[model samples]
Target: MAWQLEGTYFENCNCNMICPCSTSGLTEPATRDRCNVMLAFHVDRGDVNGVDVSGLNVAVVADTPALMSDGGWRMGLLMDSAASQEQADALGAVFGGKLGGPMEGLGPLVGEMLGMESRAITYANDGREHSVQIDDAINVKVEDFVSPLDATGAGVKVSGVGFPADTLAAGHATASTVNIFGLSWDNTGKNSFSAPFAWSA
Candidate 1:
């Protein structure tokens, strides 16, 4: 089966202004003892084995060791409540790394699977800001870092990093909170990144 997905992705993590994990390729220890993060995606266009999955939202919540590459992570997946069973299952296969794609790179790091759930997910990207609300489980919003020297107000970005996207816009979380899977955090004012992503297999 062939699958393709294109989306806007963003994440908020319990790290300083610029997360070392992003630049260090997950080799450096996080600013904190643990890395608590929420990855949210809004699929603008997608298909898996002939099933359309456009306009759907998905999220991954993770708690990893300070040095992510050491590979001990507890993670859970959240699928949009609006999805049909077939759609959800298809997405699960792709995101769970069952089907070869970018996410497969992450499969080796997960030590525990907190299981998947269907929840109401709201994702918004209004150019300068990105926000996501997953039912009562998570709430977060990030604003891009705009350089005063640049008149166009584009976000300060970094490229050639080991991430899902080729380039990532640096940002900070204005409001962040999470309570799910026995993990809780208030990462307000922490590190954040946003980018457009495309994955196929």
Candidate 2:
């Protein structure tokens, strides 16, 4: 009944094929020399301080200065409108760093919480391609990549990084949509990935 979660997310950022932020973080300089990103998550199983939060989705829009290790990120949030008020409130607390857990470390990095909105979040996947929609403001998709060794076309993966996901499957953005926080871009052809994650505290 303590706070715990198991989930997956796909992130798209304005960077080269592979994002350095995921591997080197801020210490090794950004892929494009900075970090601006949007990510969406589907919590298959979760709870916040005993509040059940299964089968819900959340999305975040953010901008960062320099390395993420140095802190100074601004963020906006979107929680699934289909969720009950309690579910939405619990998700807001975690996403906003109020409840803490895997997101606790993010607290120091975030300089501002743009806001949280309850919206219709459509998160889905069709085998290889992943898609997410937040109301009419954001929509994006990423397709898993084929690893060099995995001839079966399994997704490229990496581990031991600072991202919420411990092992993430790599991919590229197929579409990137934005209309929140003055952030705008079509990140298709940019860096992207997804991973199953677990966090407890």
Candidate 3:
């Protein structure tokens, strides 16, 4: 039951420029620190249990506290409405990390099932701008990079990480407080990335 998916997302977190997680650092955010990332998946061509998932979309809403290993976070999944019951179930299984895909490794850290919904996704990346909004669930914006002399939208890059491997990432993030699986977070600060990523089941 191994499938492949390619997509992008806009993540919001409470950290300084260049989130420590992206560089393999286990540093914690401020006292009220949190990490809430929204992953929007567009299954270019994938399936589960004989289900067709070519044009389907799914999302992963993850929240981590402080050090990200405290393991008291929550998750919520969103599936496209066009999918049939069987297809929806299959999509849920895969995105929920139950089918042993690239995201399965995070399963052990999941706190609870916040439930899944059917919604639309708006994802885009233009040169230095990256953004994605789930209709009304979440809205994230990536600011452009600043110049060294001017110190506008200063940008930085980190090697070896998830998707968008050689990321052209900026040093800023803007997001609103959100409630997913009963957890609330206004992930602000230096936690945003757009890099290349590749993982197998």
| Residues 1-201 of candidate 3: C-alpha lDDT, one tens digit per residue | 565555444455555666676555334453345676655555556657667776666667776776666677678888877678888888888777788865576677778778888776666666566666667666666664556776554456666554334453645665544555565666555566664333345
Report the candidate with higher TM-score, 2 versus 3.
Answer: 2
lDDT of each: 0.92, 0.81, 0.62
Off by over 4 Å in 3: 25-32, 45-52, 82-86, 144-155, 162-170, 175-177, 188-190
Clash pairs (backbone) in predicted model 2:
none
Which candidate number maximizes TM-score?
1
Q: Lowest lDDT 10-mer window, candidate 3?
A: 23-32
- By TM-score: ranked, best first: 1, 2, 3
How much does candidate 3 score in TM-score? 0.75
Look at candidate 1 and give me any clashing residue pairs.
Answer: none
Runs off by more than 4 Å, candidate 1: none
Instruction: Specify the highest-lDDT model's number.
Output: 1
TM-score of 1: 0.97
Over 91-111, each residue of candidate 2 has an lDDT whose tens digit, in order, gives: 888877776676777888888
Candidate 2 TM-score versus the reference: 0.92
lDDT winner between candidates 1 and 3? 1
